[model samples]
Target: MRKRLDFLSLNFLRKIEIRYRLINCFILVSLLPLLISGLLAYGETSSATQEKVRVYSMQVVKQISQNLLLRMEKIEDTSEELALSDRLQNLLTDYYGSDEAASAQARSGISKVLLDSYGSFPYVNQKYILDRKRQVIDPQIFAPLANSVARLAEEAPDLNGRPWWTLYNAGHGQRSLAMLREIRFTGNNRSAGLLFVGVRPSYFFRIFEGIDLGYDSSIFIVDANDGAIVVQNRETGPGNADPALQQGIAASLAQKRDADFIAYTGADKMPYYAAIARVPHTSWLVVSATPSDKLNADTRSVRNKILGIGLLCFAVSLLLSAIIARSITQPLKRLVMVMKETESGNSRIRVEQAGSDEIAVLARKFNEMASKLHQNKEQLEDQVAVRTRELERANRKLEALSATDGLTGVANRRRFDEALATELRRAARSNKPLALLMLDVDYFKKYNDRYGHQAGDECLRIVARVLQKSSRRATDLVARYGGEEFIIVVAESDPGGAIQQAENICDAIFELKIPHADSPFGYITASIGVAALQPDDHTAPERVLRIADQALYHAKYQGRNRVVLGSDTVHTL
Candidate 1:
């Protein structure tokens, strides 16, 4: 054996093993620093980039909101001027005689006056004058504008004399901001008519263009009242907005608060950092969004540079590791070869400890360690066998305790829940019926009060035994559900079969006839609720329990000591 082993245990193989170990250690030490530095650099860059993006986006949103408010103020001023005009008042006061020709002349004059007033303001899309009766006087100036007149009439119910501005959507994909003011004269202090000025949607669009959101960014106006996109630099298709994001925006608007840095997907399928600010003068939402990728572009560049430096360092370390590994492994090669030879029955070849360092000490210790290890091998085997037998016995005891209820000496809640879950799954898979009966001792608190606590415990144990005996099926399980409540799971049983079983259990408990002199209700009784499992995979384990609980509640309401089945027409019981 010694001669045969000398051929297989060569010196070269030992040197290769030592070289591989040294290389592994070098690689780990070199890469660890590089990994840590790269992670720290990436995290810092990402955090700074996110902060900068948030600050800039907030500034853009604020500036846009201010600009929109200014424009709305200008429109309001124009509306005030139009409402106080003398020409509009005169048109409202002049009521023609019932002659058709005179009425035509007065209508023509009124339309010309309104056209001139509207022409002064380029933002005004249309203008109208209504008489005291809310009838249009300048009908030609607002051609095919029936819908606009009707809406204004509805809005200005108290047309006695008041001015109000409202924003609304005009048909054909146009939104208009309009102001309606009642016209009055000195002698007739009451309102003679209403003056209206409608501003086109372009008025808002032109204001949104001045703000500089980067090339990939966009600014839009949404009508808060109707959730309509009023003016958009880049239009999002219908229903493309995230429902959760929209809900959040709506909630913010409802609360009359501003929403900042909300995440939303844009028309271009890119995620953006969005901020929504409500325009104070109108029910308009000014939204400014910038592509998140653009904001993080600088951080990504910094990360790439850091990774490049780390890779260079790693390459240099790897090269140095190879050189160091070769040097350290040369001496270990001889020691390892001698050890292999000794292990294979070549006892003459002894290792020579050459240095006064840890490695040399380790080489000397290896011989001593090998001899002691051989001596203790038999003892270790015996101890391992003894531990295995002990573990097996412990596992069996644990399994038995797991299945048996600690309180009632019957199946535990965990076992009952598991069995019911398995039966439910099987019933669903095989299209078979599964039923569960939940039973609770009626007036249990009263019983505990009349009798001592000890008697209450004994009563519960007796009830558990009766339930166990009543469910005679091999597949049936009786488990003590928390306190005085107990549950019985019956597999492959229909609603009728479950109900009969529950009734039998209730009767068996009554048959015990334990004397209860302090009981107001003659004898101790129980309420049983039974429910059949529906053959639906989505039906949860708790569904049967809930139904049974509901049935039990109904049984108590009807009268105690009665069994209630879930399938009965009287669902309350």
Candidate 2:
């Protein structure tokens, strides 16, 4: 029997025995979860980190966008104020006067004013004002253009007296932001002349000088209409942005005028987090492309540590499993049952260690291995919890950011739509009244023309605040609809309540006494159209919007600054 047993053991050892299988299984099972979990942890951490970076980057983009807009508005205001000069306006109004000497003196004075204003600005490259008669007060200022002011006058857009921002060649073949506005007289809104102001590329550098967007970031302003890069950070960063990357950024901005930052690999094999925000009242988008290597550094560090620890543990555990498996043949069945139990999540199940022999040593090894594996499991769970909390935090921030308008600090158009839909659904379920009011600043274009875009923005913000203050209910939503338009959603309000609310808003705006030279009230006023509905399950939000918008049109048609109800006759104030 001893001879037979010895022969069998030798043959079994020569073959691939249970001991070898145990070692292989232990090595594979131990390393596989470590590898998979390390990869998954890396993936999750990277994704979470990227999202946090994106949110942070978007916040930065929003800030720089505000800075750029304020600066651009300052430039525009300077140009408009200079153009609106009573002396300049009078000179251009009587451009064809018989007294050439006086006209020349007036032209010289106007030139002095423009030079004193825009010329003092380090960014101004060209400044000229022209009338419909195709004559420039100062020919030298308009001489650089081969097409002349006539072409500009012809090709320029007429946006109801609002300035048209376009690109211009500021000598030496550098293109820059140019503003062309049909300057008009304060009264009657008559077009007196056109003002053309071209800024140098330094204009971009001036505003973006102190803005830091990490290392090697490219911050640029792009034209939304033509996907033209108006200006980029050339003096400090990369001389020129990659064409494909710029185009991709343009395309992404085109998809949505205001978008959150996103991560993508560039054609150059470099990863970037791109963010975009629209400059108010212009077709320009402020885009920032920041490198993403730093965003992944933390995750890579964690993954490397995990990989090293996992590999070391795998080697040590594999060696111990082979030794334990070979010596514990007598209790292999019981050990296999215990391993199966541990595999099935019974980590506390222990192998009893007894006697001073190899079997006892094997049992101790198994117990130690189980204890270590359980520890790894607990650590992985902690990591998952941390990652989950991080993801939750990011989502909360995103929700807050997405729901507010960047300009007025009110709910944006998207948030407004969502609120309207949600309220409509609630109204449908409860069979309650829901009111939607579309409000517009009376003669806003004229206001912009008179006060410049900066004032217009301030006016909108003031109006938004008033509307926000007027909303007494928690269900009320005030949002900037677009341009100089604002929309309000009042839940559980009747037509009378909604109209009273609109009238209150109008009175509040009127009392503010914000001057408006073009308005009849001589101050900023609102024209509100109220549409109140007892929405059923079948009612559509768009239908309510159309009715309210139509009512708003009628209110403006009935002479502005009044509330008009959708289903009622003209109730003028």
Candidate 3:
């Protein structure tokens, strides 16, 4: 008897929701503190790591900037030394514009000096001595370099005296930067000629090879005189730095800052940091940046470790809860499956009850509920089908109302525009002729003044009915084109067909014999204009309507109650 009582007690505790609640309580007590502390530590570690990376990136940028400044200064000094040499000055003075052989010997002597001086420098791509016309003396040394110099000189005529950096865009997607300076004689400082120095940006960008600025990180060198990026390793090419970084570099240049950091959003819409530094002895800036996701990659591993341990604890707890709650949960799981089937339109499914326990009682209640729901659903579906049918009929009526004229019961202006566009396309595709007929009630304003508005409305209705009857084919349409103007669009119609239809419409309106005291005809009449054309690839649909309108004006100008062809023929119907 006591064992049976204990069994009942255990069964009472096996309810699924209750069992899971107990397991969750155990987990919260055991792992909550560990998780809280782990997350806090992770945050602190990530912040410190980011700060370190920011400082290190700035330092590396400044170091590279300084090295570049020193190299450029050395290069300038070498150029000055070559410019001041006595041999070059004497060669220029004695042999310039002389005979070919004399000039040859002087050129040979100057070339030797240039070669000797250039050997002292490590990164010179090409060096040349040019005349005032920017012609290289020894074209045989490098013909391409000579041509590039001539083109550069022609493009930048003002680059004489002061040092200048310029870009050369070679065809087939290639470019390079070069330094140019004019060489003058020593004594009177007379302009002897020019010197050309070419260097590839890759030579300077190689300095960043030893450092890693994280994934998707890039470095750029910007020219201060203009907001031009002089060098960048990005695949998009130079002068394409992020706008925020560009703005920050511009600000730094304006403020004359040596080094600084800027924070901005990256292309991914995530926060990013950049380090900016000025290269001394030159108007250049070094900028480096990386997205925050890449910068914080190291901290993510720590987070994954903490999360893995927490998930393992959760899995163990969930396993124990499932074991304890199996009896109650198993039946509930079947009930859930049945409920899903019912939701998917299978209303015949029901749970099987086994014992007189709480689960069994619940199963009985669910079966009864499912039976009632099936009956109610059938009645609801019938009512919904009826409602949907009524709605469809109402919508069709609304569409007809929208497309029909409210006053005259003809096609409205919107329907006319749609039909005209459709017919134009069809005619062009089929290489057929299309026609447009525009009609206007003669002296419509005067008619409205003499007759009442109700009489005017009735007259318009009569005209609409006559126009509708005149449209012989189902594909043709007559539409009220606002006020007393009406349009009739006909497809597959020739010029003769259009003129015949216009004549018919004019005769029918005149036969009505409605009295018009103010009209010149002594009765109501309409002027009809007919325009027709064979639609081709080059034909515009609007041109036909404009022609018809012009013809209508011509008809009115000649006399009322007549049909006018666009070819300027006035026909009395």
Candidate 1 lDDT over 227-335, as tens digits, reads 6666666544322233444665787777768656677675567777777877664566777666779877777788878977876666556644444434445447867
User: What shift in Å separates residue 364 of candidate 3 from its native position after superposition?
Assistant: 43
Pairs with backbone N, CA or C atoms under 3 Å apart (clashes), candidate 3: none
Best by TM-score: 2
Q: Ranking under lDDT, best-scoring first? A: 3, 2, 1
Task: Give the local distance difference test score of model 1.
Answer: 0.69
TM-score of each: 0.44, 0.46, 0.44
lDDT (tens digit, per residue) of candidate 2 on 1-573 = 656554443334334445465666555565667778799889988888777767766777687778877777887777777767786777765564688776676676666566556634546767777766655667434244635545766777665867788776554456667788777777667767778887766666666777776646777877766667777766642234456566676667667757656557877788877887777778777778877886577779989898878776665565444444444464566678899999999999998664445455777899999989887998999999999999999999999989999999999989998999999999999888999999999889779879999998999999999999999888899999888999999999998888888999999999999998888889999999999889988888878987787788679767899999997556677
| TM-score of candidate 3 to 2 decimals | 0.44
Clash count of each predicted structure = 0, 0, 0
lDDT, candidate 2, residue 183?
A: 77
lDDT of each residue in 1-573, candidate 3, tens digit only:
645543433454443345365576466556666678678878987989778878988998898787777766666777777778787887887657567777777876676567666633435656778888878877345466578777886665555466666665543355566767788877887788887776666667666667677757777777765656777755456555566666777776678678988888755678878888987645677888877887777787777787667755664566444444555566678889988998998878989886556667888998898889978987999999999999999999999999989999999989998898888888999999999999999987679879988899999999999999998899999999878989999989998888899988888998999999998888889998888888776666567776787688667756767878886766666
